[model samples]
Target: MRILNTIESALSGFLFLLGIVISLYSVFMRYVLGASQSWATEVYTMLLVWAIFIGFSTALKEDKHIAIEFLYDKSGPTMKKVSQVIVFIIGIGFSLFIIWTGFNMVLTAYSQQIKTIDLGFPIWINYLIMPIAGILLFIRFCEKAYKYFVKHEEVTHGGDVEWKQ
Candidate 1:
């Protein structure tokens, strides 16, 4: 679990840094060099996609995914657990759907040899980020569910909560 968390964090961090660097370079090229590469936009778009996907899993592992806590905080432990289960099921289902659809989309893109307007780079490569991120999210969801049901552990007040389900 620790290793998974570390890997997810590292991946997310690397994607984020990569995105920042690419964006900065793009900006520098446009402003300082007075010329923009046709592929700059595509590069940024790809980086953003990767960052979003990796960030999704990292957020799940960190229990930083968005939620409405007003009602949850007022509920009892049993209710909390029930809520967690419901959320997990729904979240996992949605992530799986994305993975399925994203896979098909990537396949179609690859088969068609889709390319961006300005860059002419293979569009499938950019679309691949969706499935990759979806898979990571699915893994994180399973880990959360396992910890919730099998580990039966609670996070401390100041510590990160092992998301129940």
Candidate 2:
């Protein structure tokens, strides 16, 4: 799992960097050189999509995702455990939904021969990250559930955050 998380982080980081580079290059070409690249917008948008979806798993592993912290902080121990169970169930359900819908979307795109507007690449390639990330999310959520419930470890969720007046 550590290796998998490392790989996920690397892949998402690369995609994010590539997206930023592409967007900067596009801006430089348009403003500095007075010429526009037609494929740049679509390419960067696709890269951003891939980066965000893939990076979600990495964020989950690191516990960087946002939560309603105020209510959670006020909850008792029993309520906290109950909340964790509820969140775990919801996470599993959402992961399965993402897998199912994302897979179907890819199949549909492939069958319909959907292509990007500028680059003409198949749309399914852009969507391939969805199910992969979904699977990763599922695994991480299960790991967290086990650590929290079975091992009696506390699941951190923004407890240290200080609210501003």
- Candidate topping TM-score: 2
lDDT of each: 0.79, 0.86
Q: For residues 1-165, what per-residue lDDT tens digits would candidate 1 score against the true structure?
A: 688778777876787788788888989998999988667777776877787787888777777777767877888988887888898899799889989999999999999989989878888888888888888888877877777678876532223564435
Q: Clashing pairs in model 1? A: none
Worst 10 residues of 1 by lDDT: 155-164
Would you estimate the TM-scores of all the predictions? 0.87, 0.92
RMSD of 1: 2.9
lDDT computed for candidate 2:
0.86
Candidate number of the best lDDT: 2
Candidate 2 local lDDT, 126-153, one digit each (tens): 8888888789889988988887767767
Candidate 1 lDDT = 0.79
